[model samples]
Target: MDVRPAAEADHASILAIVAPILAAGETYAIDRDLDETAVHEYWFGPTHEVFVAVSDGAILGTYYLMANQRGGGAHVANCGYMTSSSALGKGVARAMCLDSLDRARQRGYRAMQFNHVVSTNTRAVKLWQSLGFEIVGTLPKAFNHPVHGYVDSYVMFRAL
Candidate 1:
């Protein structure tokens, strides 16, 4: 798979990859009913940098990286990732994440943080851990999972 910076032209395919994940409301904290305009602004807004992973000209996954906070806390990077359901378990997400981390370090970020990783998304949680991110804290009843009801969230971080 090839991972590269995203262009406006990739928006449609990115949406196609992200839509099902958002609709599931199981992993990310975003509104399941989130609209395209909002997603566009959030993903491609001025402060964020987005990337896409492709295989044979098909967008299999995408990720967005941005400052974790403003001012003093801005040295850290924050990211969100999504892989097309059809592309799951194929290492597309992992490749995208590795590329994002490299980009984050190149952008001068000192650390990378994931503010709200759903605890029940075991695959993702484990993957993050394997990638060297530590689960620093747990926010009890933080995510209202669609099927699992209230679930915990993990604050994961890793030094660049």
Candidate 2:
């Protein structure tokens, strides 16, 4: 898959990838009730740089990179990833993550952090660990999973 900066034409595909995941309420700690306009704003806003993973003219996934915090914390990067449901288990997420790491390094970020990874998402946790991130902290009962009730959330980090 080829990973590159997202363009206006990729918005629809990006929406398709993120919509199902956001609606499921199984992993990300976001409001499932968000409307299309708000979702677009949250993903495409100026706060971050968005990218898409494509192959055979199809967008398989998308991710956004931004500073983890403002001012003193700007050296650390943060990112959110979403893959097309049809592309799961196909390494799309892994490719985007690797690209994000390279992009982070190119942008002079000193570290990358995931603020709230739901503990129940083992696939993602394992993939992230394999890619060099570590669970630096865990919040007790931080994520209210739709089917699993409350679950722990992790703060994962790694140097770029």
Candidate 3:
């Protein structure tokens, strides 16, 4: 798999990966009916550094890294990742995360944070933990999962 910075032409593929996840309303805290324009703005806006994981000329996963906050908190990085349903369990998400860590370090970030990891997404929670991120805080009933109703969310972090 090749993970690299996303080019403008990759926008369509990125949308393909995000659409189902967003529509499911199971993990990310986003509107289920968000249009392509809004999705584009959120994922590929000027503030984000977006990347794609490609294998055999197909995009299988993607991620975006940015400052968790401005000014005083700029040293901490925040990221969002998504893998195509077909690529799950194939280590695509894990690879993208490792790449993000390296990218964050290269950009001088001192830490990496995931502000709202859905607790019910056990796979992600475990992956992040295994990758050295700790669950520093939990927000009870923070996410309204489509299948699970209200669920807790976690704030995960790790120093770079």
Best by lDDT: 3
Query: How well does model 2 score by local distance difference test?
Result: 0.94
Write down the TM-score of every candidate: 0.96, 0.98, 0.98
Roughly what TM-score does model 3 have, to 2 decimal places?
Answer: 0.98
Better of 1 and 2 by lDDT: 2
Q: Which ten residues in a row have the lowest lDDT in candidate 3?
A: 38-47
lDDT of 3 at 19: 83
TM-score: the better of candidates 1 and 3: 3
lDDT of each: 0.90, 0.94, 0.96
| Tens digit of per-residue lDDT, candidate 2, span 99-143 | 999999999999999999999999999999999999999999999
- Runs off by more than 4 Å, candidate 2: none
Show how many residue pairs clash in every candidate, following the order shown: 0, 0, 0
What CA root-mean-square deviation does each model show from the true structure?
1.1, 0.7, 0.7
